[model samples]
Target: MRIRRVGAYALLLDCGEDEPDVPGRVEAWRAELARRRDRGELDAIEIVPAAATVLLDGVPDPAATARSIAGWTPRPAPVRGTAGVVEVPVTYDGADLPAVAEHWGASVPAVVERLAGTEFRVAFCGFAPGFPYLTGLPAALALPRLPTPRARVPAGSVALAGPYAGIYPTASPGGWLLVGRTGLVLFDVAADPPARLTPGTRVRLAPA
Candidate 1:
């Protein structure tokens, strides 16, 4: 892990070296930082995780804090139990369902079964509000983004790209391969937290 200064008051952790296990690393770092903060060893307002980096914002002494955690080894992300996993019921019929199945050299039922069997966790939120970039898909199953992004991917469209699975929270342009959809309301403007799928939220897709 390498720490780079971000402007005057923040630091960014470049986790490029741990690309394959970035999400787990992010989870581990966040937990460690929070633990340190609780013990009065660190101070930061936010511990945000992205595709490959974790941003430490509102830190009083960025350099010192960075140095403190520089030598610290990252632990594996904790596994959440079934009771804590959010189940999103999905209708396994999408425009790109056949394409995704073909890419895996598997039948539609096989693909659906595989996805339903795995657990996912929100790695970050980007592209749109409440749109979660989930991590769980193995490296062997990684796929490229759509060459021609859809003009407006409908809300709740369960999609995948690279090693992540995602859901379109709102109707918007997107490039991820659609494999299914859910009726779950991902976003609500008036809600306390607004987005249902925040970073670290565990999820499971169930066939409707």
Candidate 2:
């Protein structure tokens, strides 16, 4: 792992070139980092896990922290406790649903079947608060983003763009190809956790 100082408060840990087929490696690293932080070895306020990068936030000195953490290797850790599987129901009747099905030479039902068949993990939350960027989408269902972003994508919009699937937590502009919609509220300010999803949670999409 190569660590680099990105800014005053951020240290970027580059987990080498991304392994296209091994998403578990990234997830393992994330779990390890979270463990280290909880043990008080690292004073990170936020840990952002991406496909090939793990960003540590709220470091006193980015350069010093990067140098120190670079020497330490991470161990594989299993997700435990409340951070387990979360099933969500989806309605496969989006505006772009037919177009995506046509692109893959499959029916809408076929596309939905493939999506609901696999279990995806919450890789990270970004783009919008509580909006989990889920990994493990089937390769056949991996579609490109829209040519133009929508003016407003409603909350609970289940979309797939590139290799990631995500549900919009709130109404926002987005470019992802919408395949379905969910009735469940993903983000709620009134709630304790606010966001329904978190990193390390396994999510299964089901037909509503």
Candidate 3:
């Protein structure tokens, strides 16, 4: 890992390189930082994670925080206690469903089976609030984003691009292929946590 200063209040830990399992490593660190922040080990205001980096925001001492993070080793998936795994019910009836099956040389049912069978983890939130970029999709299911992104993708759209599977928390523009739709509300600002799928949360896709 490489640590670098981001302006005055943040330290960015770059996990470096793209391995098939980089998302898992990033999730582990993101959880660890949360633990530290809660215990007063870190006085940062925000711990934001991405595919390959964790940004520690509002830190009092960037250098010291970087040193601490450097010495730390990644642990197994964090204990979320009662918040555990979230099951998302999806209706596999997307516009790209048939195309995706053709790309994979599999039938539509096979594609749905593969999607429902694999488990995914929330690596980070980006693009939009409460929109999580989930990792752990089987590599065989990975595909490139649409060449021409739709002007607007409806909320609750279950989409896939590369090795990530994500739910469209709110209606907006997106390029990920829509493979399904879910009824679960992924984002609600008035709710306790706002985001249903916070970082470190595990997810399962079930047929609705």
Assess every candidate by TM-score.
0.92, 0.84, 0.92
Show where candidate 2 strays beyond 4 Å.
Answer: 17-23, 60-68, 77-83
Q: Write model 1 residue lDDT over 129-188, tens digit each, in one string.
A: 888998888888888889989899889999999888999998999999999999899999
Ranking by lDDT: 3, 1, 2
Q: Across residues 1-208, which tens digit of lDDT does each residue of candidate 2 receive?
A: 6777777799887767655554566677788778878988777888888777888889877776666676767676554543556879999888888988898898988889988887888988888899998988666657889999999999899998988999998999999999899999998899988989988788989888
Model 1 poorest 10 in a row by lDDT: 72-81
Model 3 clash tally? 0
State in Å the error of residue 153, model 2: 1.7
Give the Cα-based TM-score of candidate 1 against the true structure: 0.92
Q: What is the lDDT of every predicted structure here? A: 0.86, 0.83, 0.87
RMSD of 3: 2.1
Could you give me the TM-score of model 2 versus the true structure? 0.84
